[model samples]
Target: MQQTILEARHIQKQFHDPVTVQVLTDITFSVNKGEFVSVIGKSGCGKSTLLYILSTMDTDYTGELLIDQELMTGQSDAQLAHIRNEKIGFVFQFHYLLNEFTVLRNVMLPGLKLARYSEQEVEHRALERLKMLGIEHLATKEAYRISGGEKQRVAIARALINDPHIIMGDEPTGNLDTKNSEHVFEIFHELAEVHNQTLLIVTHDQGFAERSGRIIEMEDGRIIRH
Candidate 1:
């Protein structure tokens, strides 16, 4: 039996930009544990919109979202915030690290915020994640001082600090050069293969999508392939 990490059922979304516009329609899918799934489509195809709903960040949609089989619909803001901190890790196109903070501190922020472990434990876990990404030596340096690829790796380390059940990325490699993008892809691949991590990434990169374990293609606010 396969364990599902995240499931979206008949999810529909609309944007009331003066005139109403449907952004996503009847989006249904499930990502199983250890699965590396990619969501790909042309721009304005609602891939990012669907990811927002799946990550529990945008609640203005219809239907149900289940993480680890727990219903996410209609949850209070506070409850949802806690759930996000504890269960979902996020990576965006840009590395959003606090430039003033040290690499270690940037990674430790989420674990510290979650408050599931002591400060020492969080620090230990952050270092472990940085080490896992092979960026431990950069831990003491300021975030703004690192190279673009290093900053992105630090962002990834920060995402893993809480040992999140699923990592959702929106164009994680979109900002990287060829070498760095390949490196990031290798990291994601190893994570699924060795750590059994579940990942749902939205990207426009065709090569990246094809290399993933599965691809979910979207078109005109609907999923055309899965």
Candidate 2:
């Protein structure tokens, strides 16, 4: 039996910017444990929108979203925040690390915020994540001092510090050069195959999507292929 990590049911979203525009329509999908799912689509195709909804960051949509089999449709803002911190790890294109902070500190932020463990434990976990990403040597370096590729690796380490159920990425390798992109892809691949981690990533790179465990193609606010 397969274990589902995330499920979206009959999701629909509309944006009223002077005129109503349907951004997503009836988007339904389920990502199972250890699955590396990639969502690919052209701009304005609603793939990113769907990701936001699934990540519990966008709550205006109509539908049911379940993470770890718990309904997330109507959770309070505080509750959603807790859920996000505890269950979902996010990696964006820009990395978003605070330039002034050390790489280790950046990774420890989420774990500290969650407060599930003591600060010492969080620091230990952050170092472990950095070691996993092969960047433990750079842990004390300032985030701004690292190369772009290394910064992305730090972001990945930070995402893993909390041991999230699913890691949601938005064009994680979009800003990297070919070599770095491939490196990031391989990391994600190993994470799924060896660690049984669930991942849902949105990317415009067809090659990246093709290499993932599964691909979900989107068009005109709907899933055209799964």
lDDT scores for all predictions?
A: 0.94, 0.95
Q: What stretches of model 2 exceed 4 Å from their correct place?
A: none
Each candidate structure's TM-score, on Cα atoms with residue i matched to residue i, is: 0.99, 0.99
In the range 109-141, model 2's lDDT, one tens digit per residue, is 999999999999999999999998899999899
Name the regions of candidate 1 deviating beyond 4 angstroms: none
Error of 2 at 200 (Å): 0.4
Clashing pairs in 2: none
Q: Write the per-residue lDDT of candidate 1 for residues 1-226, one digit (tens) a residue.
A: 9998999999999999899999899988899999999999999999888988888889999999999999999999899999999999998999999999999999999999999999999999999999999999999999999999999899999888998999999999999999999999999999999999999999999999999999999999999999
